[model samples]
Target: MLKESTELSMILVQNRQQQLNGNKRLFAWALVLLLFLGACSPKTRVLKSPDHRGGNVGGTIPKEEKPEGVDKEKTVEDARRAEAARNSVALILPFQLDKISPRTLLKEDVNRSAIALDFYQGFQLGLDELAQEGRSFSLNVVDSRDSEVRNQYVAKSEEISNAALIVGPVFPKEITSFGTHLSNKNVLQVNPLAATRAREFNLPNLVSLTPSIDVHTKAMAERVARDYKTGDVVIIYNTSDNDGRQFLNGFLSELRKVNSSAQVRSVSSVPQLNEEISLTGTNLIVAGTTDRFQLRSFVSNLEAKSSQEYYVFRVYGHPLWERIDFSIYERFGDFRPIITAESHLKTWTREAKEFKENYYSLYGVSPSDHSYKGYDAARYFGNLLAKYGDNYPEHITKEKFEGLFSAYMFDYNESWGFVNKAVSFKSYQGSSFQLN
Candidate 1:
């Protein structure tokens, strides 16, 4: 990863040096980036703090330029637009082949063979697709070993001279570091994971690809208000993770928005399902965890009370929902529960399918949350490199792109969380997920 970053730095520096002879296009785009998104930070500062922000407020403003010919003006506008439409991104994951750790992910034959790399695989597919479209950008990738070492690596790896952006380092600590000290020069950190652990709420430069858990919770609450009107809403969660906090916050916020007087309850221990008394009136259960202890408890409790009148709503606080060992239909036993899945995956791309199939075939299993998420991160970053070309003189403007497993959009909020935010309902009909 260090070597790759260093190589990229050399290339970017060379480009700038070559362009100093008078490359107006590159200079113009640089001005746009430096002006709108605070891209003017010194290269050393950018490296130290990849999540740096507080600039680029002016990029959204329109600047009219009149050129010689009608054809020339149109060409200039198109070029600028193209630069704006595309930019580079980075995806830091656990894929450092040199250093291997069992705790790192995909270590076991089952997970390694299949699951842990799905997201990256899908992300790679997106890269190939972008190349086909003739848009290319450079992608900086690193593996955090899912540990503090990765944090140190990220903290110091900001030396990439002209990197446009970064997409990951899946852990929140890493994200927080980037946010707290965005030292990357002329580059932005596009966090695709680390959704729940965001301590810094709004950094203008860092962009989160996942929708805030708050968004999901609020959306679910709104839906219930629209459909159920008034009822019993229960939120089940693993109190251990901070991710639960966001979900609860969002859910509670929405409940008040829809009906300030709505009743709310939170439970951490699944075994305490017994504590949950009386299913009178409209009953709604929302579990904020994907823990086996909770899922099993939920399954047993729900099944035992299959005859009760209630609505089972499972809110996947994150991809943790996928780790569940229980089958939705069997656990609920004919009960139709609404499953909320948050993904940045584009879902319907040729490359996505290929990646999925290849992943399953290679590992003899389906891709795990870590794999698919990591893969998407990589592909998204790669797509940026493809679009910007080798010169990278043009500053990329924010625009939405259709990713393999989800749609990604970036705003100045600096939290990539929203880029992957889309809520879709999945009903388990005893066997498979049926979209309603």
Candidate 2:
């Protein structure tokens, strides 16, 4: 009887094991179905049809035969009208939905998905606003999957090929790869997030929304040059990596351009930096490092040294410093640190307040920086597309926009495409950074 009981227990354990395996398989299938549905849902709004043309729905005008010797200007105008009638925009982002798993999922995966979702939602809201304003658009959202192979495939797809405006494929590598594939196309591809220099990509049809590090350096340098006095000392503390050194070089170049006679000292060590700080005239110190740890140590040391000697100084920091939390350093405020900011959202403004309320009501959460970025890109580019049609690229530099997060003033480069040169300076004061 005891032997029989043991055999019965083993059988029951085997049955339970099989049941668990079956449940896992069910869960995996369910997750995949949910992801597929999510992709086709209103959030993505992917237009589908049984027709061979893939249901373009953008109201593209059919080409009509024209007799020889038709006026060229009239032909062009007709083409523009046709283009205006066809308003299709494609947004390609790294959703990486294919990597989702029931097991072995990581936090980074969730974060990436969240970023994509937030940006998509914000972009949709912007387009929704335009729709209400009578600007019709057929937006096709594509997932790049953050893979080069996937990006290349998407870039060559019919939807992307026909888009009036294409925004994203987010990261620098993906942008370059995708843009390279579409080099022959006349479509303007906006680099939505990467702050990498425009010249690096050399894509003539690219529009970079994020201000490059060089732009930040130049802005800070100009500000420093403007504030320079005869008695004031200019110093650079540069214990940075190659990327950071590029910023330092750019800053120095711009500073020299404005004030060729300006005497600036460069120091690497803490003791050397301390020796240059003066108690008399204002000491303008540039913290030329992108390293957050180094920045914290440097700021802490400066604060300690300043307190000990009552040094009167102004600290000009790298753009990356904007992301570092200096609130922990009690004396960081005393230095009056200034950093170049690309996005300055005035939350107190009526427009900003309304946007926040509307966004919260729609998404049940506050908008992230990416959300603001996506909204501005959609609104700015959508308006341009609606206004100028196929020739919107010609008018890109002519238009200036002030959105919730950023002010856009584009300068066209023959080699590097369009660069957003608008940058704002923020000074740390009264426990918070404010526009200066």
Candidate 3:
């Protein structure tokens, strides 16, 4: 099942050499490797031991060869001591290796495994950096297969039981299922990707890295409240969909908290919203729908109406608006829409440039959002483990990190565990979106 150390330099070097042929070939090679890796059975792949030296090793931990006169008890004791001293971290991801078949493998299959592969590569790079800085860790990578039964089984494994920190099981349902089976309440399980609210899971030891939708709503609402004026009217364009309504409700609740008497109205159509807008005062338009079609239609129609009448307005959009290409719509720029982003990597910055260079050098490809997230997660939590040992969770709230993609400032919730409150608000300025 490819139980191996994080010493992936040899493999990377070989891949990089092949990549020099052409960019197209390089990507093809990467996909091929991903498919190959995904064909393996789910098993625990252990990183190299702190004491290990010389060549890279793979497969299951070999049986220790004892000398004829060596005392078995003493050897066992020493092994236990070494294990106890070294920090153990486990990463549980849905590689879904079983889904890949030799005869039926397609580009779609490779794409399915890409998220796990990208994250793993970035995570390995982070660990490599830690190792270079003289931090020792025993990393265990296990495939969750995105199965509830599999998660339950893996949760009870020795690797999970011994781990000081567990990094994944990416989806919300998987996180809940895995957490349910985990017996060790002290071990911190990180929800690396999911944007689901922490309170829903009710996992006391869970650390949610992604800020929830409610956080985005509150952040946007607070910004609106801060800049609010007496004559300015706040109008919400909401849909009947639960997601749209959730943002609408959350924003209203937070806005009311700051300005109890704020002039606010909710409308379902562009025409109704246009009627509420005044030419004299600034109209704060909150687009509460995450649906791309509705957003496009609403924005286009409102922009046309506003431009024709010369109405003063600014738009606040749902978090999902980050996915939409507003630049494509010629009228969107005029609205000067502001939206919440979970993470924003300034690629022009020195740190980002170096990260991209290093990532490309090693993986022979550009880093994706998952890759950045993985690197940050590994580096941040690995540092915490090195500094705080088993008591890392206690210090999580106190430790703040600004990584390549995301900035983390956790607030400890007694019921929901550590929830990252960090969120970025970006505004459409000139040709592109910039941090507000």
| lDDT on C-alpha atoms for all candidate structures | 0.48, 0.75, 0.77
Let me know the TM-score candidate 1 reaches against the reference structure.
Answer: 0.56
Model 2, 130-183: lDDT tens digits are 765655666777878788887787888876767888899899999988988884
Ranking, lDDT, top scorer first = 3, 2, 1
TM-score of each: 0.56, 0.79, 0.85
The lowest-lDDT stretch of 10 consecutive residues in candidate 2 is: 1-10
Off by over 4 Å in 1: 1-91, 96-122, 140-159, 177-182, 200-204, 230-250, 261-281, 289-322, 325-331, 344-402, 409-420, 432-434
lDDT of 3 by residue, 392-432 (tens): 88888898999999889999987889999999888888766
By lDDT, the better pick of 1 and 2 is 2
Candidate with best lDDT: 3
Index of the highest-TM-score prediction: 3
Worst 10 residues of 1 by lDDT: 42-51
